[model samples]
Target: MNNSLTNRLGELAKLFFKMGVISFGGPAAHIAMMEDEVVKRRQWLTSEHFLDLIGATNLIPGPSSTEMAIHVGYIYAGWVGLIVAGASFILPAALITGGFAWVYVTYGTLPQVAPLLYGIKPAVLAVILNALWRLGKKAVKTSKLLVIALGVAALVLLLNVNEAIALLIGGLLGMFWLHFPAKRNSPEDNTNLLIAGLTTGATLKATAAVGASAATASAANVSLWQLGLFFLKIGSILFGGGYVLVAFLQGGLVEEYGWLTQQQLLDAIAIGQFTPGPVLSTATFIGYIIAGVPGAIVATVGIFLPSFFFVAALNPLVPRLRASKWTAAFLDAVNVSSVALMAVVTLQLGAATLLVAKAPYVDFVALAIALLSAVLAIRFNINAAWLVLGGALIGWLFFTLGLYPIK
Candidate 1:
């Protein structure tokens, strides 16, 4: 019996480890890959339950998708599962980013591997688009939900309202519409109230992260602890994945602290994207530059440590929230808002991705690949890793044939 349990734990570790290695295109893609594995392939959780977890992550600070992995780990295998899942998921990216850090420090330049990302980015877009479709179908169940989702998207994409604020407002709207439609509250509204209190408090914490930066004071010599603490704080606070991380790092490390230059930080972000797993592994690259192997270790731990605790603390409440009618409404609001934010990010990324320099018609090859991949995903439900690899090979062939020349 114990061996069977251990084997199950091993499976959890291996699954997340594989995901850590191949998860490209950032958090949306990572979450899509996870849904394929955990919900569709493994049947570990239903789609509805997974949506609840995703919504819960939005409420708390830290990397949302990474926290999703941790939450799944806890749900399936308890505390050990949480550790194994989060660490296994993070390990590959951290090591890859750490190696890049070594290369950067040794060479003073990030490796130029445009062909790989060129192929992978389009494929990732297809995967993310498919995931959004599936989750959006589940999230937007009511006309009211459709309105909330659309409103949040407009606020984020058009009005440029804060994403965190948009999500919180969605939750508040859910609290009223789902729970008190006629100004009548059931006894369980109190439970939803408690859940709302916890979620709002966490949402406020996430909102404050926008202004977060590295500790004040620039120095010619930077300490390992400072690097670790800086990333740890950002990891615990930043909510919108790599996009937000880029701005935070630019301000803190480049402007506030003299540890890295603007170019170096951009180089770090590029390397982070080129590798698999979390883009937050950019911390590993910067950490190794600042200190060394020890710095790499500390930075990775500091950034990810809070995710473990955040999941453990917030995950249990998801079921409680879903179990009650009122809090369930709250979860629905948060879920739609989460998917709405995903849509906004996808639009922004797609715009940036479809534009290519020195190419005829702005990255025609990638656009073709992305369109093809999207059709295949929708029609056949193909595995994402295969699409990524296939995209890479196609890009490499184009480069070799000089059909799509990289200038």
Candidate 2:
């Protein structure tokens, strides 16, 4: 490799590896951190381009943030950068989760991380809000786009629509609404198109359901190959987000195969949630429980392989999509809708982090951390990784001093 290419690869490795360790909260938080690093701090991409990547990543099935890392890597380096960036980000999370899985298998219990999460969740909210503010400016370029964003947010926050579906709705809305008066199509043609679209969507969902059921019925010994194939299928077709993986695993692993109990599944999800990087790393925990180290390695590789492929295929088309007026409108709407989803998630996280269910009803300390973190990030331009670490330290201190009760 040339010296310049080698240097870029080194940069990708350093940046994503650190992000893997410190990216808490989930995909939204992870994406937010990436935006800060790639767009704001490093200037590796413009906010507009970053927003496009987010829109495109949302349209895909795999982990959005991990794909974003891979997308950024490709933009910076090449196909090699794609693999390096993805592996660098994924390796730390997989290793950390693997260690947790080993402990869970050995001790039959999980670690207590409530306090660390208590502080980290609020700080993550701040980081997400900062990203939303920055990206929304670039995305909501017109009043119509703003309306589409709001409509998508309502679909998700009120109607409980899936986020991926919401993005599709936004894209379609933007496509037709923004590209009006250009051409006229027969009403019959429009109706047929709508019907075909709906039919295709329904067929895909039904097919996935049937596939899951078939896999359940055919459950057998958890061989390395079978486990890898199971996750590979999921990585290719599983949409919505990592949380949706639960239903599939519950049905296939717990109900059909008896490979994992309900509690074990829940604990695996818990470990995935609390740890940094992709929630799909829960596959690592489950694989360790079901098979062994080899299973964990296979599962991690299988579940993440599709994202690398998907991003590589889609990244090159983004600039082309922007080049076409109709597709450009669609991308614009998708971009705004992606931002809207992040907004809704941030609000949900805020409520969950700042409000107590029982006595007191409000977590003032968390609120303070969120507010302070936001101020630092917005005004002082503090790095997100440090903010997350600081939140964890504060949470630990509070827990140690008996200031904050463990959740």
Candidate 3:
């Protein structure tokens, strides 16, 4: 790479590392941090391009924010940039959260940590709401897209359909709409060649093979190996965003393997919101709790490896793919389904905090703070860190005023 490119990549790596460490409040917060660093601060990519990547990643199965990081890497420094950016962005949060998981598992209770998380969850809710609003404004541009988004959200809330399947169906629907527009509909505009080349299964399979190889060589433990393989399978087959992965993780880790308790799993998820980067870094926490530092490494790499492979394998063809009406339609469908998955997750979290769980009434305060934060975010475009801190203050105030005892 040339000097300017090399320097830029270094800067990106440093920024991503900082983000991984300090970027808390789940995927939405992570995205906001990224927007601050990459789009606004560095001006590496246009806002439109960033949204396109978000849309594309949302249509995929794994963590959309993580994939966006990889995409930014790809855009900035090609293949090397992709690896560095993804790895750097993931490592700090993985290590910090994983360390905490290790402590929580070994000690059996997180005494000081619980209060911090209690405050953070409300902020996370605000962060996610802000993200949804921003993304919705951008994604739901056309009337058709709005209809699709609303319809997908309703189906997810009511039908209990698998998110991956929902996204796949959406992609197919988008493809159909793009390819065979109605009389009043505009013709499908294929503008991205890279996405087009990904239409073929053969290319995806090859990418899978590469990902599998990377996964095997990157880790040590047999459990880690299994975790890697499992996540690889999920990443390969899944086609939505971070929220969809939650169900899959719950099934595989909690139901199938019995590696973690429901409580532990939920706690880990809460921790993910309190930290930064990708919500999927919950894997790092799980891995550490299960197997220690090695496990954390395995889980982090296992979870994110597929994104690199998919994006790299597909990037060369996005230009051509963007031009294909069929592909455009497919991506559109996937995008709608992805939002549906988010709606489902939000509902589930709401129910857990509001209806099902009795102990954590602090969640209500969190919700209120989140709502307030969302309003601030939309109206004033405030920074997420400030909002998160504000939520923390609310938590402290509630605890001090005897509204709820600090757990």
Give the distance in Å from residue 156's predicted Cα in candidate 1 to where it truly belongs. 0.6
Clashes of each: 0, 0, 28
Runs of candidate 2 with Cα error greater than 4 angstroms are 184-220
Q: Summarize candidate 2's per-residue lDDT along 366-395 as a digit string, tens digits.
A: 999999999999999999999999999999
Report the Cα RMSD per candidate.
2.3, 3.6, 5.7
- Pick out the ten consecutive residues of candidate 2 with the lowest summed lDDT: 210-219
lDDT scores in order:
0.83, 0.87, 0.65
lDDT, model 3, position 178: 49
What ordering of candidates by TM-score runs from best to worst?
2, 1, 3
Worst 10 residues of 1 by lDDT: 211-220
lDDT string for model 1 (1-407, tens) is 48866887899899999889888888888999899889887899999999988888888777777889999899888888899899999999999889888888888777767877778888999999998999999999999998999989998888888777898888779767866766576678676668768667866766575665555655456777787888788877876667778888887888788778878888888888789988888888888877789878988899889889888888877777888777788889999999999998898778777886553647777799999999988899888888888888888888878887653
Give the CA lDDT, 0 to 100, for residue 73 in model 3. 90
Q: State in Å the error of residue 372, model 2.
A: 0.9
Cα distance off (Å), candidate 2, residue 392: 0.3
| Model 1 local distance difference test score | 0.83
- Top model by lDDT, which number? 2
| Candidate 3 lDDT over residue span 99-181, tens digit each | 77877878886535555556766666666665655555555557777667676666666786555445555666566664675
